[model samples]
Target: MSRATPPSLPFPPHIHAWPDRSTLLADRELALTELHRHSLGVHRVLLLWLLALAAIIGWSLLVLPVQQFEERDPTGFLLGPVFALLGLASLSPSVIAVVLAVRRDHQIRQLLDAWLALDSAPVSDVRLRSPGLSLFWLLSSLAVAATGLWTSFGTAAGAQAGRSTYADVALDMGIGTILWLTGLIGVVKAVRHYRWALRTLGPVSTAGRR
Candidate 1:
């Protein structure tokens, strides 16, 4: 009887079998690089989110002392619903991010299963990171809220005294200036980043469609 030999396995063209000693080290390094990249993206998203939240909280606190509710008149009732809606709207992106993160985690799991089964794995598209949409929403909400607060409170305060003091004028000016500056900065940054991301990601999208 002739001795039987094992048949060689075929792999996809993109996959290469490394020599025994190099295999472990090479794969570990590749995984490390991937993990590092993912970490950086997560870090950036978190940083921008926290910065936006902080700015909102800070601006709200600064204006809280100056808010006068009495002279707000008929529009006063709208504040409750407006703020509630703003809260809901502002939460949308965070919720979307969480859902995407969860979905990506599931995809990673699926990819790992394919890898372990020695099957060809699908490539993941790296999404272009931009804080543009979130920044826009944040700025818009802040602007509306800040403007409402100023209008309502300033009117109420001014109605009582019928005159604006230097201190009152200075405080009002300072708050308005800060809110405007922050909103403008956010808008500028968001637009620039968004444009860049769109341009950069356009080719990626086209390749994906093919």
Candidate 2:
């Protein structure tokens, strides 16, 4: 039987050229390592759908009817479970994203450590920073944080002024907190990465590679 070669990885670029063939092997290996996490980029979205299904199934099969199955009171059986379901539906996305972000950060740090130990020279050639994406993330996060601040405090102000109901204010605050924390975390993570890259990557600190 004839031997077969694996197809090349999907590399994103308009023009393709590798000028220096000397470090190509190391560079390819680095790309493959990065690709491992990038592969999760879209697949992780399935988690949202999975969570939604879980919520629905849990509500239908367990929550709705199982509450004092013999009890005849509708309020006890329905109202409490409905509110809990609503809470889960509202909060699960943020919880899931936070978990994923933490996991990804760990994976990235592990990769960097492995590369540092191996003295991977290819790290120098590629620009590890994505300026455009980074800019978008920073700006978008700030916008979200700003909106959240308004929603959080502005709603309270309205409620105190008798312009809004307590229940309405509580809902708004819940939403605002999620947005505020998410945006703040994004901003902090970006800053942390910048500082870390500065200290670890170029000339500030010594890595085995560069």
The lDDT leader among the candidates is 2
* Model 2 TM-score on a 0 to 1 scale: 0.59
* Candidate 1 lDDT over residue span 1-210, tens digit each: 111211122233233554542453345334423532342234434444454454444444333333433344455465645644554455455445545654553454333323323422113322333354446544664574466457546744664354654435544554454445444443444454455435533444463552
TM-score of each: 0.34, 0.59
Give all candidates' CA lDDT scores.
Answer: 0.43, 0.52
114-200: candidate 2 lDDT, tens digit per residue? 444433443552344444444555676677678878988987776764454444555567667656776676566556656655655
Q: What is the Cα-based lDDT of residue 164 in candidate 2?
A: 48
Q: Distance from true position, residue 3, model 1, in Å?
A: 57
Best by TM-score: 2
Q: Show model 1 residue runs off by greater than 4 Å.
A: 1-125, 130-162, 203-210
